[model samples]
Target: MSNSEITTHDPTSISRKSKKKKWSKPKKIWVSVLVVFLLFLGGAGTYAGFLYSKFDQTLNKISGSNGKTANAAFIPVATEPITILLMGIDARGDGETLNSDVIMPFTLNPITKSATLVSVPRDMEITFDGHSRKSNYVFPHYYIVDKEHAFPKTKEFWSNKLGIPIDYMVTVDFQGFREAIDVLGGIDVNVKMDMCYQDSTDGTNINLKAGQQHLDGAATLDYVRYRKSNCGTKESTDYDRNLRQQEVLDQLFSKLKSFDMVTKVTDILNVVGDNLETDISPDNLKQLILSYMNIDRGKINFIGLNGEWVSPFMVIPDEEWENAKRALKIERMRTAANPNPTIDPKTRLGTDMKSNYRSSGNNASSDSNSSKSQSSNKNTDASSKSKEKSSTGSGSKATPTPRSTNNLKSNSKSNSNQGSSGVEADDRVPKVD
Candidate 1:
């Protein structure tokens, strides 16, 4: 309106000024409204980010439901090696307490990435520091004797005995193990021989034939625990049963990684959170899970403890136990370096091929022809062989049993020629010295 006094007070100038004022007021209103709307949108976007962060935190907490996962706080021991004690507990009741039937300290060389399973027989007569009882009963005492500290102490004792530093302990109760197997739906195992056992006292009657079989929880337990029950006279022993356990473990692992296994694995994690006891730091656990997540099926090697069942001592000796430990250590080292290394031929055979031959009664002189002839004409052949050789047993020969082959095959070829000529039913484990 003040355009040089509106050109000396002109009427047209006054109308134009009035229209300009009206248009300017609306523009200002629109600019203010737009700025307010933009501010509101920015505030909402910030709020959404905050809410999403909170939601993510809640999900993580739930995922780490287990006290172990949540409570785990680890301080790295500088340059110190990490090891794990894997315990297979055998509990027959609903109680929380457990006594491990199989105790193996698995040492992992972080540098090598190899792992070894050193089996401790339940009946071993080692000194239990806190408990004044046999070594076998120490597992249950853990619940009463500081529950948290017992297993760790046991780990220490085993470490001292084997000269290794054990950093973790993973204990799985029988129910948990069976439940894990069930979660996998089932496992496929090669039964080395017919297992027929009749035990009226335990109310267990198991009859599993030789060859491969798909096993559920109950049957899987029987396959591993067949030693307690009656197996036929085909020379199938606890060693064979241990081999079956290894197979089942492999199958269970494969099933755990399958496409259909996600839901079941989630369920399993819930169960494991409730049941498993491990000193594995949450970070390490996560790392291990991530490292092994994409691993191929055959990369992992499952092995059994090679030892004898001593009825008198009720425990396996540490001699063979040590050998097994060494073999496992080497295996772990190899596996860590290369997850997909070419496993040896004998290692592929699940059972102990050396045992098959050493247990055979054929001597160095006993060729395949003689063995066949002796089997065909038992009485006549036995008399002739007895006269030819001082030792006598129908088709089977007798030799002074060596104290220990040290895993080296017996020099007597005939004595070592028993059962399929060192070939196992399923090749998965190699013969060791």
Candidate 2:
């Protein structure tokens, strides 16, 4: 049962008058928040330093799987890519079981000004410390096991899964997402159909009419978060929900360009800061803004792992899961450094797996060097073959990307900024009876 279920008394029969009264306060709060967003845009450089000092206080540092500090994993070079894991958590202020409703490994290449954003389905299963569960719990479970070094353990599993290094991570709370959107005076989007749903237990009351219209923060939440629709025609399907999330993101950023962002930057920062936790330093944020801020919207790549699109939970294919990792630049194309002659060097995704894995399966960072030494005879022999890419002509470079028959789309034109406006944060009510 959801935490809301435990709290709300007779949710279905709750007063409609109360929900209407609730709307008045959020509108006022969002207006104030929107003013801050513009102020933030108007003078980012001037305030970046001051904000950095305060933002530094929010850092939740943890060592990487390779034993390097999270900050140490960054590669500022224009050519080399950097990866960031984005977590969208669904938990109100109360002490509910916090699950990652969304997980996206976002990659950026500074030189090419490109991005590869892979949204890992929350229902996809992943192995963590010999225990397999849905990937969404990877962090929350670790946070419970060892809060101080939770990220390290979680990062290790993903690192092995992807075959690439993750530089940083940012977690966004759902409430903050609502606040941010509401403050921006809601977002304008085209609605494909009428959406009406309510859940007393989860405190979700989503009811929006069909067609193009401006959605307030409350309506905006329903616009993106509603995966089940009463209007039928697969309105509530996961695939369509993902598309809606991306659409809201694209529209939100598109609207930012016309705003006068010089009134209240600090306030907006405060509103958002409280809801986020990340290891990315303030300096790095500034560096990204100055160097990689003007990212080409067209170049942003959306990645989805191939899986059995089972309702609510997707049984993702193994190699396709690995392919999603490579899209994040975790699994790199094999160079001469690889000793595993069985795998082809040009193959993408999980091509040249890992080198430092040992037979005992203890890839502990403390004994990383030793693990590599004992694995000299690892993997299948040279007889194993890998899938190869075909080119139209000779002298053409084979793209190292693995085969993925999944959804892929990029953001539309927008204001130049360092942040990836791909993922819309998540929070869902129980299925309406």
Highest TM-score model number? 2
For model 1, state the Cα shift of residue 351 in Å: 29
Q: Give one digit per residue, the lDDT tens place, for model 2 in 230-273.
A: 44534465446666776776665455544333333443444563
Top lDDT hit:
2
Q: Give the TM-score of candidate 1.
A: 0.54
The clash numbers for all candidates, in the given order, read 22, 8
Expressed as tens digits, the lDDT of each residue in 286-320 for candidate 1 is 34432332333333345555444332112334455
> In angstroms, how far off is 241's CA in candidate 2?
2.2
Runs in model 1 with CA error above 4 Å?
A: 1-81, 94-97, 109-113, 124-135, 196-205, 230-236, 270-273, 291-303, 314-319, 325-433
Q: Each candidate: what lDDT?
A: 0.42, 0.48
The C-alpha TM-scores of every prediction are 0.54, 0.61
Estimate candidate 1's alpha-carbon lDDT, on a 0 to 1 scale.
Answer: 0.42
